[model samples]
Target: MYDHYDALIFDMDGTLVDSGQLHEFGWSETLNKYGIPIDRPLMRSLAGVPTKATIEILLQKFNLTPTATLDEMNDFKEAWVHDNMHNFVKPTALIEVAKKYHGIKPMAIGTGAYTQEAITILGLCGLDKYIDAVVGADQVKNPKPAPDTFLRCAELLGAAPEKCVVFEDSKLGLQAAASAGMAGIDVLLVHAIENDYFL
Candidate 1:
């Protein structure tokens, strides 16, 4: 099913590796410690959103004034995830797909995760070698649901957006891919990794 594409673009956190749990936990733990109510479902839905966007949404949702600076909250959550990521993250079923396509079609990562975090997770999962480029949240002016990340990835791959396929686990990522004029494969990530739809 993927043969037609010249390049493949992947969303890192949930699509390439199983790190959503750590992210959710980090957010929940940090917010709770700051006396903020936990919204598990919201966090899940906002999986591919950038840290600042996620924080702003949560602040408005809970009607809580920020005690810490936005940078402080972002730093804390990222640190929490980093401290515990090694314990929970592992290669997903899509790693096999990445391996199969490695050195064949060009592959890149376009994620809402900061560049360092995305690179760290890709390295941890041993998927970094398979990818040719990574366009991260810090590098883009707009996050998922906008086409910037994916478009940039396609540019880096020297492929047309329509010739690239995006593997995404979030609705926002799918929207971003579509906005960039690329087809999308929705990698199921609820309880476990499932890429059967494309197989």
Candidate 2:
């Protein structure tokens, strides 16, 4: 299915790894400690946004000024996620696609998570070896929906933006792929189809 693309780019959280719940737990725990309530819909809406960016959005959504700075909240949430991810992070079926093209085609991960955090999670899922490069939100000036992350991945892979295909689970990610002039595969719909087929 991906034969035509010169390279493949994947989003980490919901696309390559089943780490959404882990992220949600991290945010929930962090917010609770700060006396803020968790808003699942808002969290899910900002799936492909960077950690600090998401926290900023959440604070605005809740309309509560926090004692902690955005960086502090981001650090606390990321720390919790890193500490607990090993027990919860798992690879989704789409990992088979990455496994299939491991060396045949250049592959990169472009994620909203910090670069090192993405690496650690991929390692825990045994997917780090399959990827040639990783571009995190921290590495780019703008996160998903800006195309910077995927474009950087394409550049690092020596592939043109139009020659790359991105596998993503979030609307922002898909938009980013489009903005990068890359084809996008909606892994959520793909997973749903796969599940139905298996059933």
Candidate 3:
């Protein structure tokens, strides 16, 4: 089905794994500790952003100065998610796409999560074996919407950016894919269309 593409790149959180709720919980806990109110809409809008970047955005949005540094807040949030992710994280249906093209095409995960965190989450979901490379937010100077993450994945896979296809679940991810000059497939819309086909 992906014969035209030389490689497949996936977004980890909302794309390959159902860890959004866990992330939201982690963010909520961290923000609440600092007395910052939870902003669901803003959080959802920054779906593919890095934890530190998200914290920065949140602080800016709330118009509050933080007692904690961005790195400290990120560490807190990441620690919580890492502790609870294995209990709640599961592979999404888009994982089947990765599996289908596993051996036939090179596949990589480009995520806004930290490198080790992405690896840990993929391991929990039994997806680590299928992925050839992983590019995380910390691994590049620029994260999603800048194309650095996906471009790094393609580089690691030795695939041309224009010849790659990115499977993502967020607008930021899609924008990153486009910026990287790859085709983007929205997993949510794909699943919705698949459901309609069955109906």
Candidate 4:
């Protein structure tokens, strides 16, 4: 039913994988270790943002000078996720949609996750084989809602942004898709509308 779209772009975290809370927990632990306190709600709202950007924003908000390099903070966050993912991460219900279009249409992941992190999680969920391309934080100079990541995925798939539909679970991702000239489908509603398929 998504035949009109030349490509499908999926966001890795809350969209394809149930890892938002896990990521929030990771950020919390990392920040706590640094004696930085953060508003959990604010942290949750930054879901689709890259770790580096999130750290910068948090530091700015708290008026705290970064004690660690951006790379170090990013590394710490990812490591925390890596160590604890087995307990809270898994493919979300949207994998069914991804599987349905696996061979029929080109699909890619445009994520704020680090390249290796996205790769590892997709592999863990058995989704790596289905995704044709992956554009991660490491590959983009700008993160969502900047549109760079999603646009890069469309480029790698040789599809125009207007011809792709991005599945996202966060407002930042939706904004990115719109900025990329692509339609966005919220993962939360995808199931209710799964049968319709945007035909």
Candidate 5:
């Protein structure tokens, strides 16, 4: 299902890396410390949103005003996650894919994560230099499900949106790529599809 596209746009957390659960745990711990409870269904809806946008969603969903800046909360989450990454599993294919795609086609990362966080995690996994371009939450005005991040990523990669294909696990990320008129490869459904590959 993914072979037709020229470039592969990857979502960092749950798609290419096995760190979404860790992120959720970290976010829960950090927010709970601030007395910000995590609402399951609501949090899921914010999956592909920017950090600030996620905070806004949480605040409204939880019916509480933020006690701190979105940046501060995000910093807390990133710190907690990085501090606990040893407990998280890195994607086995990260380095191999980079090596295989060295000259195959350009690869870019479009994520709701902060650029610094994305770079740090990729660096920790030794997958940093393999990427040709990156579009992070900090780089776009709107996040996933809005097409801004993917559109910006396509722009940075010098690829047309329609020609780009995105690899994602979240429904929001898939919708974002589709909304941008791009093909989406749902890594979560890889096992059931002949053309899909598990990461």
Candidate 6:
């Protein structure tokens, strides 16, 4: 429960912003540009995966050579996303939640997004200053479903991993939070538990 937590951590893409679909679209389009094909559903499922890891997995899954350069593909994806943020969903629930808890409890970002991109988007959405910390995928060796990113967020937030609560929309993010010994919020549940549960 969040009431039991000293800090609140959020997964950037799906949990806070509506960029998950854009990310899927971006990756899908980028892969296609490389002559590699990927299904939207599959890329959506891999939302919280690290960039390089996603490239590697997609290459194998698409039977393409592992020669898809991570940096280049990321450039393509970012360029597309940078051109389309206003049209994407804003995941206002996250912004509302952050406003509700900003001063009362420490809130931080633990995401599998590139540091610069994450900062740019969060800044655009006013989340950069709102959150206590932002831990990017590049800052860690292992990303979700590993505890590295979340744990780093907890550490930076000055909260014990077990004393923090994580809000995630993907299974991988949930696994990462659980591995960090924190409670996980499956944000996409249509009939999700109410604020009482978090409190």
* TM-score leaderboard ranking: 3, 2, 1, 4, 6, 5
Off by over 4 Å in 1: 189-199
lDDT of each: 0.85, 0.86, 0.86, 0.83, 0.75, 0.78
Clashing pairs in model 5?
A: 1-195
Residues 19-137 of candidate 1: C-alpha lDDT, one tens digit per residue: 76677778877787666777766777777888888888989998999989889888888899889988878778888889889999999999999998889888888888999999999
Q: Candidate 6, after superposition: displacement of residue 106 in Å?
A: 0.9
User: What is the lDDT, from 0 to 100, of the residue 149 in candidate 2?
Assistant: 99
Lowest summed lDDT over 10 consecutive residues: which window, candidate 1? 190-199
Model 2: how far is 128 from its true place, Å?
1.0
Pairs that collide, model 1 = none
Residue 187: error of model 2 in Å? Answer: 0.5
lDDT of 6: 0.78
The digit string of per-residue lDDT tens for model 4 on 52-85 reads 7888898899999878788888788889999887
TM of each candidate vs. truth = 0.93, 0.94, 0.94, 0.91, 0.85, 0.88
TM-score of 3: 0.94
Report the poorest 10 consecutive residues by lDDT, candidate 5.
190-199
| Global CA lDDT computed for model 3 | 0.86
Worst 10 residues of 4 by lDDT: 190-199
Could you give candidate 2's per-residue lDDT for residues 1-199 as a string of tens digits?
8899999999988888888678777877898888776776666778888878877777787888888887788889889998999888888888889988989999999998899999999999999999999999889998988999999999999999999999988889999999999999988677641211101
Model 5, position 159, has a per-residue lDDT of 83
lDDT score, candidate 4, position 38: 73
Model 2 ranges with Cα > 4 A deviation: 193-199
Consecutive 10-residue window with the lowest summed lDDT within model 6: 190-199
